[model samples]
Target: MPAITHQQALDRLAAHQLVQVIEDDVASLTSTAMSYAKHDQHLTVAGYVLPRLLARWNCVLNASNDEATPLYRDKTVLALALLLHKHGMTETAITKRALQAIDNLNAAVALSDAFFRNTDAIKALLNTPALALKKRPSTRDSLTFLRAQDVVAIQLEQYYYAAYVHEISGFNEYPIIEFYRARFEHRPDMAALQGCAAQGETYNDGKTRISLHAVCGMRHVPDPANQFHLIATGITDQPDQSQLGASVGLHTISNLFQLQGVMRKTGV
Candidate 1:
């Protein structure tokens, strides 16, 4: 049979239009979850969603040899997370019944973007979330950026950061620099960072544009037990811009890093 597009599947709800067999499976599982939810089989509903979710998660990270996959694990997981959140947060009966009908529209962002690519439609869709929240608020929430003022003068400080060299927006389109920024926001001034360059042409004011030597660095305190309470001094952000600086530090992290999803916890 001729396959149908994902759009057709959503627009028509005609199972025959499903292009990929995976889409069909998602739909079928959704239907089954709803049926179970309708009959107040909440635990069974979890049984249906969680396993499929994990299977998708495994495939997302290529942890398993699953044939079917969900590209936007953020969305699928966020939806499930949100559903579970709502189930616990609200007393409404409808959600408890329609647990399968996820409300996050952000999930569509990645899908449509992949499908349309450079189209203006992709841009528009990204800015237009059905929930209308920050697009990819994970880093913003998880990590903090520090300024020069908040620097704490103490010992035992440790450093964790990531480095990247990007092509300038209007300048060289490409530039070579082996520098890093301390993004952790817990304490800014203590980051030992000096004046950092405004990478983007986003300086609305003339002074911001003219300023040189922007403080760029990264700070991470994963386990506070080994806490670096005071600023132990960073390598690169010294007084003069003549420092070769320290080598970029990296930790072998797992895929288990928390996804800053929209699912709010209780009283959150």
Candidate 2:
């Protein structure tokens, strides 16, 4: 990197506040997007540096401890695996960790399920977590009321933006992928995702309890032994649209990832 560019990156990382640091990234991405419009080199640089960035992020995750659902960790390693196809110059650790996450996918999910079921497991899973489980109200909607199982998923979102961008961004893209393939003309089933907020079993067209139904689902594993299933076609209206457009084309529908479009629970 040139002196000016290197200094800029340092400055961005140097912000004392978290939001400021994010602003720096947003500015950098916005600039990168503008640069990409004028030259393909910007995009090429992004692709080349993505794995290295992901690796650094995984290192950050490894520095912490969390015994709950390893979904974030799993997603992180899987993403790194996809980007890092070859083992070279100390990339072996990342590859090994990522592969291990893949091999243990089923065990991880099962453990998470068990963690939710047992009271002792729940206590063990919390490094320091805030759990909010409201009983299903009689007159109120079930969609807004998270199930007891949702405690884990809520924790998944607690440090969501900070901790698991790679996994969330990568696995969460499935809904939009299917939505596009279907021409975005109809709603798809999203309930297959189990506790997913996008699943149609949650709600209907009403704004108070809008549903994010899944239209399609498929295994997104690195290998057959590890089945990393991804479901898509749920809808939501929250996401950073400017970031999405700057990163790629604008997606009108909000899927589970809230990045692209998700399908409605009911067929159109």
Off by over 4 Å in 2: 1-48, 67-71, 83-92, 109-268
Output candidate 1 Cα RMSD: 19.9
Q: Lowest summed lDDT over 10 consecutive residues: which window, candidate 1? A: 258-267
Which numbered prediction scores highest in TM-score against the true structure?
2
> lDDT tens digits, residues 43-69, model 2?
533343344243224333453443323
How do the residues 177-243 of candidate 1 rate in per-residue lDDT, one tens digit apiece? 2222233423334323455422211133432111112211112322111122234323333322233
Cα distance off (Å), candidate 2, residue 187:
43
Task: Compute the lDDT for candidate 2.
Answer: 0.28
lDDT of 1 at 210: 15
